[model samples]
Target: MDTCCAKALVTGKVQGVGFRRAAQEQALKAGITGHAINLADGRVEVLMCGERTAVKRLAEWLRTGPGAARVTHVEFEVIEAHAPDDFHTG
Candidate 1:
């Protein structure tokens, strides 16, 4: 049960479509903690921290967000950060 962190930038019809909320739901389900925020460049930035498998799953899910989202691309990268106690959107 290795723990890790991953940051992903999701583009295309992501914002204003409940992407962050959906991500939070998925993160909770996976026992992950972090945040999903809307970037000024019209992308959704998702930060996931938890088990390696859960992080990977959340990252993969970002590729095809909620039904309202039209994800065109996702840029993922592992990083170092202090994880929060629960998932959030900002």
Candidate 2:
């Protein structure tokens, strides 16, 4: 199976609002592997690895996050891809 990876910088109302949890759930559902964390600059950074379609879906969700989240921007860039047996939140 082919795979792709992306490192995304998500900004705007993304912390202390279940953003990380929401991202974790979404990533798992999309069969992705990576981690999402809150940065000191009030932004969320996520590294996602998975199939192309799944990665795209995850990115789309990042743009319009959970009901409580107000994501103004989701900057995504392709990165090195790897094969992971299971998805996880780190």
Candidate 3:
């Protein structure tokens, strides 16, 4: 399983919607490392690195967000892998 890294910015109805927790769960399930944080501007930022397939699956899940989330946009970019120590919510 090849590895890949990505930095994603999710916007629209993201904050205060359990988005961070969902991200943490997904990352953990996928054996990925990174953190999800809510920015002051009401957007969510996620930095994740893991097996390519796992990360891609996680990214797809992020597109829809959690059951309570109203995701409107997800902007993501793939980058060089910098495997982090763990997955967390910030």
> Which numbered prediction scores highest in lDDT against the true structure?
1
**Candidate 1 error regions (>4 Å):** 81-90
The window of 10 residues in a row where model 3 has the poorest summed lDDT is: 79-88
lDDT string, candidate 2, 1-90, tens digits: 778999999999999999999999999988999999999999999999998899889988899888999999989889976656797898
lDDT of 3 by residue, 2-89 (tens): 8999989999889988999999999998899999999999999999898999999989998999999988999999988655789789
**lDDT (Cα atoms) of all candidates against the true structure:** 0.93, 0.91, 0.91
Alpha carbon deviation, residue 68, candidate 3 (Å): 0.7
Model 1 Cα lDDT, one tens digit per residue, 1-90: 689998899999999999999999999999999999999999999989999998988888999999999999999888975547897899
Order of all candidates by lDDT, from best down to worst? Answer: 1, 3, 2
Score candidate 1 by TM-score against the native.
Answer: 0.87
How much is 41 displaced in model 2, in angstroms? 0.1
Candidate 1: give the clashing pairs.
none
TM-score of 2: 0.87
Against the true structure, candidate 3 reaches a TM-score of 0.87
- Output the lDDT of residue 28, model 3: 99
